[model samples]
Target: MKHIRNFCIIAHIDHGKSTLADRLLEYTNTITQREAQEQLLDNMDLERERGITIKSHAIQMNYKYNGEDYVLNLIDTPGHVDFSYEVSRSIAACEGALLIVDASQGIQAQTISNLYLALEHDLTIIPILNKMDLPGAMPEEVKDQIIDLIGCERDEIIPASGKTGMGVYDILAAIIERVAAPVGDPQAPLQALIFDSVFNPFRGIIAYFKVVNGEIRKNDKVKFVATAKEYFADEVGILKLQPSPRDVVKTGDVGYIISGIKEAREVKVGDTITHTARPCSEAIQGFEEVKPMVFAGIYPVDTEDFEELREAMHKLQLNDASIVFEPESSAALGFGFRCGFLGMLHMEIIQERLEREFDMTVITTVPNVSYKAYTTKGDEIIVNNPSELPDPSKLDFVEEPYIKANIITKSEYVGPVMSLCIQKRGVIVNQHYLTSDRVELVFEMPMGEIVFDFYDKLKTISKGYASFDYHQIGYKQSDLVKMDIMLNGEQVDALSSLIHRSNAYEFGKKICEKLRELIPRQQFDIAIQASIGAKIIARENVRALRKDVTAKCYGGDISRKRKLLEKQKKGKKRMRQVGNVEIPQSAFMAVLKLD
Candidate 1:
């Protein structure tokens, strides 16, 4: 206990956290030179391809310094804002954090967000200036800014390059000297915090935890405080490269306990685990279940694959508790599941995993935020899909969720960014200058406005130099209406969307034009119309394919040609009156991409 350190690395996306972890592993000789790979901690293929960390991973390392053996437990956390909940839990399980900042890019929005989270957890922070090998590295300026913002001592900041393994050994020594060890009594009753869990086909649920008080050994009966389910610890081990069996995990150490529970949901993250015979008096606090914010419907392209998709989702949810889903049927897309996710990125990753890992072809509907609707009878309900919204005649008002958005960018791109925000119905909250060349602008905007393509547009407008972060503030009242799309006077429920009344005309026109481009022409002319309630806001006509009816009348009387043309005109008019348009899947997705 005297020479043990439990800490994690926190940084913004692409800030070299994974590289720093790799270098630390190399310094401690945890893995051989030939066996080491890039982003070793990022096990998911999706994470590696995207160059981001989505899950939190923990590893143990042993180092000798000053003739004393020290045990160092390093937990690597995701850098994206969508995974902030996971970051929080990881921070809670540690005693210190290494806040890495890019020497070239300086501080970003996620960097500030993560710094505040670490502060909230009341952990020791060691600020490290990383990526010093780059040509644009400016360590001194970053050091000054870190001191100014975080208010730490100037000399405490370490300048290192993760790519070249420079100053990494010094960082390891700092962890031993500066970071404090865990404070817990080995004799006290058993109490551990389960920060993460994974599902193994043969081993059942494996819980990764930190021993807070007392010790846990193999064959010990442990009880989950939240679920009240008891299971004997089949095995106890530490993850040093891989799980190595241990006789006992004493206080102040990080290890895994293999409980015989078959389902991952049984062992919730942040739950308290204690010996069933000598259980603690109370459960641990700050153990809240993860709730998803974004909702969408995902269906199999082949209706027969619905069961396979269901089983795949079930297996995936065992590892990812953030995802919630239930059976749903769509008139246009057949049977599916309405799934909830933490954010857009979370939603996309799950979709990709289902496609690649499960080998299923899926069609995803447009994502939506939850809305509050009040009916005329004074009954209030939450609507997750626009088609579920009650008719305008029966509704009193609707409220949409809003977020407080933070954008940090160079001063040269401020004008264009501000214009784009305003177009998205963003209300400026405040603005301040971070430095001579950088600016921070804050805004309060509807979550729906930014959920579609706001981030991509922001990166484009700022030339990929801006960083954006946002959090839910609350709900706001707005003059909102549901606009429906009609093909030849028939309503299409899947194409319905809720929009602000002020932009109804332009939004309707955009959808109509996009539909016209996507919908294939038929034998009869098609009238594409967008309407709010009974009022049509925009319309476009897709002309029919024409076939020369008189082409067969060669060297015939003029009357014969006229008769044929007359008959063709009457047939077209009848077809227009009773034609049923078949909208392809492409058209449904095309409308979702409308600006």
Candidate 2:
């Protein structure tokens, strides 16, 4: 058995964890410079574009140091709190963690959140201060800050910039010296936690796991604990987190096994994968069911392409297991899926992918928070759609999901960021300086505020230095009520929402503008009114279309007119056909536009 060193890179978003992982891979010569794609661990294009790690990626590399060949298994983890459970699951598979902190931004709320999770897991933390070469760099100050946070000696800090490759070798050396090897008997029972799974049509389902105990080779029969099924490994191979796949891996190794299993849902995350002969005695904890907080309905602009939408979602789920979907039917929107996601970015990514990847126009409903409400009959109603909310008198109690947001920024921009937070009904919970010049502020804010452009406003106010993160604390009671938008005396299901008392007017006006821009000029004047129960707070109108069915086609345009009618007919299929006007799928999507 080789000496195992497994550690996860934990940090806040945009803190260079993925970059650090890339440098480490390059440091060990596991991946050539040509293969050193930026954001090496972010396998998704969306992840690379956003400069965030959305999923956990793992790779193994060998480094010869001090006359010994040390094998390192590095797990790259998502830093966002929406995926905190994923971080924990990823951390569960390792014995140590390399906590990456940006030198300029100091430690953020997400950093603290992840750091606490690692400590609770009893994982050895090798702190690495990243982005040291950036302007306004303060490695020394943040190094002390990291030491104070981890309660370790000052020398425990690894000062390095993942971008520059400086001190990367030293960071690797520290991992070997400080982090403990994987603990389990190689000769005992074979059991491991499936941290990740991927699909290859020919290979079926390939499960990647850390072999904590025992050993399994080719033809070893294994059972998925969650699915209660057994299968023999058709193939087993070690992964290097590069484009090339290696042949074999044993104890203390991160690799994958193909068991000829085809079902993707059966191979679930956090499931115990064990050898059938000698099963694991202890089941791993921390496999909490992940719940997506934000909900949106996704539909094809062309109704006949509904089948195409379903296929696109299936392909997307193969790579991203976090997205949840269920069939939804609407009188106006035809058939769609009520999709659930981690947050706003997640929702936007999905919508963008459907449009870009599937080559189909998609309409998405406004993001929403799932809440538990009660009707006057005392029946419990789980309100996922704002349209589902009862009238003010019918509602017994209403609450919203509260998020504990932590913001890290320079000292100069704290006041403006706090002002924005306060405007969004955010209550300042605590504040502390990460360093003498860098500050970390914690606040209790509604997820609704964050569902908007809070991150953008934070960075704008703080001059791009402020980093923000949020985690669901719990649901809190509030005087918030739904303000439904009605067009022509009929509620536009997509344009209804629950808003706080103070900012209801502003939110209503924003939605009104979106509707006016989206709902094309109608044949008859269409009134877009935003209201609170019986009170119309905001109103706008879609003026009648000046002309429609205009014959712009030439004499040979008979076929051209047919094509136009076919396209318009396809578009009209998604319309509600309320009376004389046709509202396109774009109108439903207007509710989702933050701009």
Candidate 3:
């Protein structure tokens, strides 16, 4: 057990977490030269193209240090705030973490938050200064920032360049000397925490877990404590570059288990796996369940594909456990599932994955956050969709979810950043200077405000120098109203949203204008209106396609031309009554671009 050191890499976005992992793998001789590539741990094509880690990857490595062999279990984690849940699960299975900071960029918001997560788990942190090979690298400035943040000594922080492989050996030496090995009794009942899992069409669901006690052998009959389902371990193996099957995976080791379980729900992440005959006294305490930050509806383009969509979602959920969904139906979109996501980026990635991986074409509604609606009778209802909110006559008040936002940026952009937050109905809670030029501003802002374009605008305003992170701070009462978009006289429930009263009129106006441009002009005029209950806040009209009815009467009498015009007008009116405007898919997505 002393020879096994389990640890993970945590950092802000684009701070070289995967690059550093590649160097570590190369130095430990875990992957041969032919197997190495950039962001080697990131196997997803989406991850490589976007230059970010969307999922946590686990791999085992063998190293020889001080003439003694050592086994290292490394899990690489994503840095985006939307995927913090991934980082938490990775941290739960490790004893230590490598906190990598970009020397050129100094400390950012995600770096601080990820560090706090590791500290909360009581994991030993080894700070490393990455990107030292860059020309603008400020090793001393970044070193001091790390010292002040984590309260570690100056020399303890290692300055390494991931690109050139500098200080790679030093990082390996630190992991071996500093990270403690897993501590568990081999005789104790089997208890393993399932951190992640993936589905296979040919095989079955493959679950990756870390053994907390005892051992799991091939062909052992095991049961999941959460589900109470039993299955025979058809295959057991340790994770190498590829899964290497083993007869036994003992205590303090991480490995995969395959029992030919075809169902995705049978193996849940964070569930405990134990021997069916001699199960552990209780299930192991795992990470908390993920709370999605955004709620949206996903319906199949073809209604008959609903069941296939459900199965695809189940399999996708096994891979990305952060997704939460339940069946729902809408008047305009028909049957669909109300899905919860971490943020806008996370939601977009899931939408793309659904189309690409499962070949499921889906239509997503406007994303919103869950709201608390209290009624006159003092009954509180949790509303995830605007259509679910009670009428204003019966409602007492509405509360929206708020978050404590942390933003780190250069001192000069403080003014613009503060103004942007305040414009979004945010209140500055506190402000502190992290360094002479780097400022950290804390604000309490409604979660709904940032669901749309706040992140993009912040990046643009700060010129991509600022980093932002946030966590939910519960709900607060606000003057919010439900706004619905009306095509003709009918309301499109899928486009409804709960928005603050102050910005309702302007937001409605923008949506009306955007839809006018996207909605094609038919033979009949289309009335695009945004309303709050009985009041119309904004309205626009897509003019009807005019016909040259008087072309044959070019030299006719004025009465003849007028009669022909009148006849055409009557036909258009009749057409308007029976015509059904088909709201294009682009119109649904246009709501998100009404900047």
Model 3: runs farther than 4 Å from truth?
369-383, 389-480, 520-525, 542-579
Candidate 3's residue-wise lDDT over 390-463, tens digit each?
98999999999999999998899999999999999999999999889889999999999987778868877987
Candidate of highest lDDT: 3
lDDT of 2: 0.78
Residues 364-394 of candidate 2: C-alpha lDDT, one tens digit per residue: 8776667777777888787777767777787
Number of the top-ranking candidate, with TM-score as the measure: 3
Q: Candidates 2 and 3: which is better by TM-score?
A: 3
lDDT of 1 by residue, 101-200 (tens): 9999898767877888899878999999999999999888888879976999988998899999998988998899889999998998999998888777
C-alpha lDDT values of all predictions: 0.86, 0.78, 0.92
Ranking by lDDT: 3, 1, 2
Better of 1 and 3 by TM-score: 3
TM-score of 2: 0.77
